[model samples]
Target: MGTPVLFIHGLWLHASSWEPWVTRFQDEGYDAQAVGWPGDHDTVEESRRDPEAIADHGIDDVVEHVAGVIRGLPELPILVGHSFGGMIAQRLLGQDCARAAIAIDAAQIKGVLPLPLSALRATLPVFKNPANKHRAVSLTAEQFRFAFGNAVSEEESDQLFERWTIPAPGRPLFEAAAANFNPHSPAKVNTANQARGPLLLIASGKDHTVPETVTRATLKQYRHSEAVTDLETFPDRGHSLTIDSGWAEVADTCLKWLRGQSL
Candidate 1:
C-alpha cells in the first residue's frame, strides 16, 4: 500500500476543503484523511454562525491535533497543509512526527524578510480590528473572492465563496505576525531542525496571501535540510491552489514527489 497522506486545511476552511485532493490520493492507492482543527465546524455556514468557538485555537492546539491523527496511523504519514495548516505541518516536522511534509502557500517562519504588499493587504482587515485578536471573523463574499478565489471564473469563484468560506480564528494570525519577535509564541516552528524528514515547500506564484518573495525567504529556515528540501512553484495558482480548477495537477505533483522519497 502507498504511504498514508494527512491533509490539513488553511484558515477559514474545514477539512472538507480537501475533498478533491483526498479523492485523488485515495484513487492513487494512498490512504488519505482530512483532520479538522479542534472546535472547527463541519460546514462553513455553521462555522460562520459560531465564529467565536474557533477564536482561541492556537498553533500548539493544531500541532497536537495533527500529531494525534498521525499517531493513529500505523505508519508515518505524509503531512500536507496550506496556510495555517502549512505552518502546523512545519511544526510537526520539527518535532520529528512525520515521514514527509508538503507546505503549500504557507505562512512565513521566524526571521523571514520582505513581506509582500499583497499579503499585508489581505491581512489588514483582520489585524485592523483589535477585537479580532481574540475573536473569529468571517469574510464577506467580496473578501473571499479577493483573498482566495481571484484566479477562478466568476461563477466558480462565487460557488467556492458560498461553499467553502467560513469564519476563522484570529489569534493564530496575530500570533504569527508577532512570531519572529515573541519568544513565548507557539506559532514559531523550528524549521532548522536537521532531523526532520523530507519537506517540499510549494509556492503559488500568484498567491496574494503569500508572495513568492516571502516564500523564498522562508526557505532559509530549511537550509539545514539541504539534501531533503525541494521547492516547487505554480505560477498561475493563488492561495487556494489545492481547491482551484487545476487542483489535481498540484495534488498529482505532490504525490509524484512523495513517491520519489524513501517513505
Candidate 2:
C-alpha cells in the first residue's frame, strides 16, 4: 500500500459519506479508509435502524477509537477529518501519531472562545433538551438545510440530507458547549506540541455549524506551538462543502495542499 490516509467523518453523516473522497485519494495512489465512530453501523440503513450504538459517545470516545485504529495500521497515517472528526484528528495529531492532518470545518476545540450564533442555532436541536446529553439526536431535513446545505439549493440540500444523514450522540456537543469552563475538558487539544505533524485547517464562510470565525479562533489556539499549522477558507461554501455537489473542488484543494508536504 502507498502512504496510509485515514478519513474521519463528522456527526450526522455516516462514515460512508467519505466514500467519494476515499476513492479520489486512492486514485491518486494513497491508501485511504474512513473509520466510523464507536457504534457506527456499516451502512446508513443499518445505522438508522439502531441509533443507540451511535449515541452517547463524546469527543474523548471518538479520539480514542481512532487512536486505537491507528495503532493497528502499518504506519502512522495522514488524518483527513470533517466537522467533529476534524477535531478528533487534531487531538490525535497532538499525540505525535499522525504524519499530518487536515481538519475541514472542524468543531470548536477548547480555548476557542468565539461562539457564533449560527453554531448555537445549528446545535439547538440537541441543546434544547438537557437530557439529550445522553441521547442520539437526528437533524430534520430543514435543520440540515440550515446547518449544512444553505450554500447550496433546496433540491440538493434535501437530497443530501436524505442520502447521508444519521443520528449523532449529543454528548460531544454538550461537552464542547462547556469546554471553556471545564478544566479537564475532552474538547482540549495539545496545541503546544512542537513535535506534532503538520496541520491544515479548512473553514467554510457560509457554514452555520462551524463558522469561519470558529476555525480562526481554533488557529489562534495553536500560536504557542512551533509546529506547522495553516488555515484555508472557502468564502462561498457551507458546512456541506465536504459532501455537496462540489465535493471534488474541496477534495482537490486538500490534495493540492498535501502535494507540498514531505509525505
Candidate 3:
C-alpha cells in the first residue's frame, strides 16, 4: 500500500472525470481515487438518470461524506479537489482529516470578499431562480463552455461536456453566495489552523467560474497560519484545466509538488 490520494470533483463533473489523474498518480506510486459527493451515483449515466439523488446536498453534506471516507482509509489521505470540492478539501484538512490538500480554483469561502462579474455570470443559471436552491440544475452546453471551457476550443469544450457533465445541486452555490452574511455559513473553512497539514492552492488565470482574484483571496485567508501554504497558477488555463487535454501538465505539477513536500 502507498500514501492514499483522493480526488474530489466539483459541480457539473462526474467522479469518473478524475480517472486520468488517478492513473497518473497511481503510476507515480500513489494510491489515488476520485470520490463522488454524498448523493452521487457510481456512474454518470446513473446520476443523470436520477437527478433527485444529487439534489439538495449542501456543502456540509459533502464535507461530512468525504470526511467519512477519509476516516475509513488506512492512513490520512492527501485531498486534491476542484472548485467546490476544493473548498471541501480545505474544510476536511482543517479538521485534521487529511495529511495535505490541493485546492484548485476553489469556490469563495466565507471570508473571501472579491466577487468578479464573470463569476456571477457563470453561476447565473442557478441564481436566476430562488427555487433552484433545492433542486438539481444543469448547465447548457453554451453555459458549460463559458464557465469551464472558455480557455479551450469550442469542439473540445463540447466533447468534455458530453462526456463528464452532470446535474449539480444548487445548495452549495447558494450557501457560498450568502456566506458573508451568514454567521455559521457552510462555505467557511478553518484556514488559520497552524497545526493542520500542508495546503496547496491552484488557480487558473482565465477561469470565469472562480476568477484568479477569488483564489488569491482564498490564500489570504490562511495568512494567520504558519503552516506550509503555497499557491500555483496556470495563467493560460481555464476551469477545465483538470479535465481537458492539458490535464497531465497539471497532474504532473501536483505530483512534483507532493514529492517536494515528502508526502
TM-score of each: 0.95, 0.99, 0.99
User: Which model, 1 or 3, shows the larger TM-score?
Assistant: 3
Alpha-carbon runs more than 4 Å astray in model 2: none
Q: Name the regions of candidate 3 deviating beyond 4 angstroms.
A: none
lDDT of each: 0.83, 0.94, 0.95
Give me the overall lDDT of model 3.
0.95
What digit string (tens of lDDT, one per residue) describes model 3 on residues 113-188?
A: 9999999999999999999999999999999999999999999999999999999999999999999999899988
Candidate 2 achieves a global lDDT of 0.94
Worst 10 residues of 3 by lDDT: 38-47
How many clashes in candidate 2? 0
Q: Distance (Å) between predicted and true CA of 94, model 2?
A: 0.7
lDDT of 1: 0.83
Per-candidate clashes come to: 0, 0, 0
Pairs in clash, predicted candidate 2: none
Clashing pairs in 1: none
